[model samples]
Target: MPERIRFLRERAAMQERARLLDGLVERERSRLESLAQGNASAAMPLLDLYSDSALSEAAGLPLPSILGAPADSRAVDDRWAAARFCMSLLRGRKDLYARFPYALSEAADKNTFLAWLQSDEGARSTGLTPASQMHVVGLFSGDFAARARQAFLADARIRQVLPHGLTPAGQHGLFGWFMQHVWSETETHLRREEVLWLFMQAAENPRMELARAYEFTPDWQRRFPDALTVFGWPEFASWFVRHYGADPRWVDVAVAPEWHEPALQLRIGYGARGAWSTKYPLALSDVGQARALIGWLGSPEGDAGLSATARQWCQALDLPAVASELLKPGVNIIGHFCYPSGLRVSVESIAEALGQAGVDTSLRDLRTDAKDDPHHVDFGGPEVHDITVIHTQPDPFFPESYARSDLAERTPRTYRIAYWYWEFDSIPDAWVDCAKQVDEVWTATEFIARGLRERLPIPVRTLFPGVRLTPFEVRKRSDFGLDEDRYTFLFTFHMMSVMERKNPLGLIRAFRDAFRKDDKVSLVLKTSFGDRHPAELQKLRDAAADSNITVIDQVFSPDEVLSLMNACDAYVSLHRSEGLGLTMAEAMLMGKPVIATNFSGNVDFMDDGNSLLVPYELVKLGKPIPPYDADLEWAAPSVEHAAQLMRRVYDDQAWAREIGARAKASAEANLSLEAAGRRIRARLEEIEALRRQGR
Candidate 1:
């Protein structure tokens, strides 16, 4: 006989065996049921659970004659309920029926098989464990899905591939693989419900087959993008539910991890964003069009469309109608203004500068509308702005904040721009991918731009940072509760920033070494968000011990902080690195001579003519510094040189005043609000020109 014929013969033999076994069990079950007819529980047992009714009354009787039944005899629903009640009495439980074996078979096919397995003759003949007996029940259930589960579980090839864990997730993976084989062999298209039923049955028990099925499936993530639209196609939907464990939702698609393929996740995010614009629709007939929309939405310009709100809007209208909404022109700075973090302050400074230069600018909090800070500015409506300035860290801002900002659907015509800042030489891999998603990338300094331009395949521009320092009443040492006549050396740092990189320790060490316990000079270490870094705060306290250092661990408002800075004789920073050191610039603007490490982003403004540059040797980082690793080298400021500068500045008041004046002049000339505004407006104009050309 041919191999195909032999295989068919084996399958047919198994089917015949199953049929014979089922018949024997059914006959024995019926005989036992007759013996248990007198039992009280058997008097419409299942029906009584719903409502008391006699078995005789339910059997082949009109439902209305029974208590609370529908009056109409033609009511199929009432008739079926009555029929089910009568059937449940016949289907007996262990104590309900005297002959439980017969009752079990009547209740369910699996129950009958289980009863047969427990019998002395059946147990001796089968020699099956309880788990094995359950497997057999699935096998003899007379359904392809049940048989498939048994065949897959029993297959030697499958057992070898099965992983140890039988978690629901593991079962899903196995089913995803098994589904491919099941679908490929299926002669007729199965309904989604039918496919779901098969999976539901297979997942009832853990067997080697599930692992085999999971291992067999190839490039499951590749099928995901198609899975969303191919809902009617049972195979795709089955695979999707198994892998993802839910119907495809916008949040799941937008934030899928690497295992799902970041590229696909990115496209899904884009597609989800684009679907909001009147130019785009939630549902597309063409797969190619859907994919294009996804990719477009994922881009920087379409970032606004990915929000939950955008999705809700798109769901209500088709693409044609959404596209018909007229667009407005003018630049909008969508950033983190709701908080008083460094990013928020930076964004506000840029926006204020642009306004000063007569540029039409507005502010919109992208991810959050949180009205926490008293200083947060309202930019009117997010819709009125045409050009978007995404002020954030590249990878982080894009993935978490910008991806859900929902600007694309709201202002689809706006030319989206990203102003990003990074401290280290190389950007994160995610950031590199994000750079291309926008039309142009802006950096605060050329130092930052140089690193980005070297790797990013996008237009990169340099825009210097601007500051709006509010003038506070010039307070004496007595005003801040400090001893009068003490020459205060102020060192301010935000605890939110990396304490090690900020090198507050270096300043503390230098301060402690330069000044004596009895010296009239005081070192004021003003830091905020101490709770975030309690360990660092403690370390600071320990260093300040036995010295004339006043550690102010408190959050001060803008004016209060300005008063503190203005009260100090000089501002000092012995930082290991900086990304446009904002405090140092602010100190310079205040005509206060700054002593800082002559390395990294601060090099953009810090020069020998205006500020004291501490000499340092390039040293490898002691530990992993996020984007920069142990291999990365940064300046380790000379503590000896810092001490010398501190003492020199304290002794020569006239020289310090002259340097502070020059520092102020440099800041006014280079970091003025007008200068940044001019550069930003020019860039926006270029972007607008390009947008017009593309149109």
Candidate 2:
């Protein structure tokens, strides 16, 4: 529907004109050959044979009024004229093709050429003769990436969201970027799926509920930050997937057309095999840890199918050996683990459980001085065997004094274990100390893995940070309306959070420069402070206002952000770095492409074929910093190159959309919910194995 798409479509028609010429020339040669051989034939030879009196006569019509052409000069003249006409059309076709690049279905284009031949007298007059091959020397031809882009873009949803190619009509430059990124991503994506499973305690009634609606969404940069964050929880995830995709439920309990308009197909995943919901009130990561422990306990027969390592973890948890049965006939664990603000329950429950189970308990006895109360669950515990803890942060939670002093002051010297200790700023020392006593280490990303492997004598597998995506509710373009059809830029800038790695100051400056260079542009910053920049925010606002920029800020649900992105034309991150930049993937899932810096796990999903790569350039703390922030400072890598890229999107709507579409394809391919979950599940297995060893 966009102008650029229309152009590509029309250009394709023009390109096919030349192919028609090829057919004309071939026909000429056939006619000439027939005449040279002397043949004259036409349906009902009697008409040409004797005219009412020829009743049973024959014309030398090649000894055969059997055929229609004179194996004579008539055929020769027909061939010559056919050749000339073919040559003329061929010349024009070549010229147009050489000048532009666009899409054309070879089969369809051929059919149309056949129709044109019937109308052109010059071509049809060569009757009974085949077309000849024309050797027009200087013809032009260009290749368009049809099959490749089609594999990604020619989907029903894609056709619906961006009916025509937007990349061709707008800024040619932006269009190119979109094509390249989307192509690479599509080449990789073989399936698109969003699996939602409802897991609760078996006692509460465990059943798998499936969602039934979906939408072709936009890229992260095109969506608001609040819209992005709301997806971090599970309830939101279940709701979004249910509404945006097919309802897997037998009967819909909650149906809201305003929210469930079918926009995308829902594909199922491995979630088909259920897991117990664990019915706990916490992060899945913590649940994973619990499952690992449960796996440690051997079978009640004292030797179920679990591995030796899993058996050990079971022992650590003081869980009874597995039931004589290897699999719990009708049991599934989906949501039984929940620990917020740290693990719940007191040490006494731990000690009593272990003590009753006949496990060793002589080192810890905080129960004596337990002031948190006996039944309160936080009371002291008896001696413990080994504690296998995981680090979710990049830095150590305590000094050696805090990490070891407490345990040393009053506990046994067993295998007090630690995994992925890089969080310790001084890991070299932590490694040597831990290695001297503990077992195993873990890393979250490739960057961290490489760094840890270099320093420690152990191996590290790149584990993913625990993340569960929440889905977006569907809504109207006007719900969070921006007055114009202008491309809307989105950023989830944490008001002033030290933990985040987004580059605020750099973003402000770049946004101002890019938008100021053009008037028909808008930048919406999703922050807690609504356009009220605390002095710092003001400077950026002042710069943007001076440049005649449209700035937006507001509080809305994730669905609203989805609405805005669907209504907008493009997305821009232009940040320097990101671990995985979940937002980046989310943007693509929404069908909007993104412009992200070339760094970190963002690479795991963002590629040139699907995303715009911007140069991130910024300085902090006297040296070049990375994209992730942990300590006192963090800088999302920088790109000094965004000015040009941003301007192109702002000026060219078609170009921006092509890029967004490409990005959407990438997310759907590689980072789809199903794909990400599998990766998470695999890592969960590894951690389970590791913790069991220490147990």
Candidate 3:
């Protein structure tokens, strides 16, 4: 009977201890919530209570309650205790401000910060760099914590990784440390989603084996493209190495080519599905590898060595072993390659020319899919190369296609070149900075290069756009189900390019004034990207409501578009300005007389001897389009004059045919693939000569 009584007493004592621990945990959790809600008055007390000894003493429990808990403990006692400690250390506004210093400065910044907190991908947009926003559950009170916990538990990846389950201490310990380290490593492009994904993969398996991760065609690669970049984070890598040991897959690292060694250089980037592929700098999977190469290239010895290595690699890879950097160096031209638009046509033409010039040219698509030209329609995958040629708008923010957001700051050590243009007399302020950064500024025309050079310190080169007239399958008016009896006037414009620049409305006005309703003249307004500007397209439709205007809104394949140009009686462009007037050149190459404003870039190739150049007067812009200053003047072709020219082309078929024949001849002499190839070769030689002379 005495033994039984003693056992009951001990049982009661144990129950009391358990209750004490639960109560302490509850109190700490409450304190954390208070702090999270901006109760600064309770912060110091909460901090004191969260100390190791204080927490242990208050709970009447040992450190092992949390430190040695199972992976999947859903219980709140020690979980709350550990969560409280983490919260105390990193819960308040101060903690957030510390990570993102500008978060609370301006109203916009504050809104952005709060918006991030409320976002579905909070970790991606907020102070929780490497940390998952799931940790925020510990920072709030009542139902909020429960909801967060439930959501976290629901994640498939998390569930897969945590078979044993998540303990509060484990969450706080590893995650907290990782996040802190990530916060310190500023200037990283690592998204919070990517970190969480990496952590889950690392934690679930714990084996840390990474061999299959880098495989050229790993099964998991299609699902997890960002897997490799995670290893670039030193904190995660260090922790992973310590816990899981070095990955066996990394055995190839020892054999990986040195920075200056003769090995194939694969230029890769991220894709639409967030998978890293051989696209552009944006999809770059191996940040650490690139950085290592960058460091080496920054040194003179490394630079010389890499230059020699690039040539050797080119030879081994069966790429064009071009002249050295002094002339035309082997270049990786990164842009929208397979896109079937006029701009893409120009880009492809340049790539072909570069190839013909004996320069190793790899055309990388920007991972953009177009019905006319899907991703990698021309060339893709890993290859040997040197230098990076970004062919897009200079400003990273200005709807730039090839300007990879990450490359804006993480400038490569190679001879970076930006092939860009602006419509105005003075380049945009943003473009000036971009130009200032690049080794060379390649403009499509002397007009643009001269304008930019006046303001920029960088050397500007006139790299005239190449025109390649490949024989396309002949398509007729019936192919588009158009009126076979009517004479068709074709005009093409991309909506993404500002409407005011393309001046489609002006063209519509000229066409309306030129021909009568009874006249057998139909206008084909070839428009693309109508979805982006529904209202503008509507306006165009409204303008053409009473006329014989056939609007082909859908993007057509290059062969079809070229055929459409061929079927047209004449091509007309009342464009205010063009970078190179690629479409005008294409029309000329197709044996079609081009009626274009005799100003800006068109003047580079258009002339009265071969084509009709509509006289234009310089007109001031009403409002400033960013990059296009209001003070600058663009050609405003007289609508009356355009109408007169159209009448002459219609009434005098023999004269038009004569002009068309000359246009084809002019295109052959000035804008042919061979001519462009020669130009590229000459320019490359000049660059090589300059480099050899150490100029």
TM per model?
Answer: 0.52, 0.38, 0.56
User: Compared with the true structure, what per-residue lDDT tens digits does model 1 show for residues 153-258?
Assistant: 3333333333211223334333333433332232353322233234433333322222223322323322332222211123443443333333333113332222
lDDT for residue 177 in candidate 3, whole number 0-100: 23
Better of 1 and 2 by lDDT: 1
Q: Residue by residue across 1-695, what tens digits does model 3's lDDT show?
A: 99999999989976875574455345545544565565545332211222556444422346443223322212223323324323333323455545543332224334454345546565443334323334433323222122222233223233222211222212332233223322122325222222232233233232222322222222223333322331222332343223322332432322222222222232321121222222223212234444343333334454323334332433343222211221224566767665556657777888888777777675556534223232332243222233566676764432443322111212224466777766656776677766655688787888788788898887788888688876788878988888989888999888877778888888889999999999999899998889978998898899889789988787777787888888888999999988788889989988887899888887888888988988888988878865567787888988999999888888887899899999999888888766777776677556655654662
| Number of clashes recorded per candidate | 13, 84, 15
Give candidate 1 misplaced runs (Cα > 4 Å): 1-329, 366-380, 402-413
Cα distance off (Å), candidate 3, residue 284: 25
Best by lDDT: 1
Question: Whole-model lDDT for model 3 versus the true structure?
Answer: 0.56
Please give the TM-score that candidate 2 achieves against the real structure. 0.38
lDDT for model 1, on a 0 to 1 scale?
0.58
Candidate 2: regions farther than 4 A off: 1-391, 394-444, 456-459, 465-469, 476-478, 496-501, 516-518, 529-568, 616-620, 623-640, 683-695
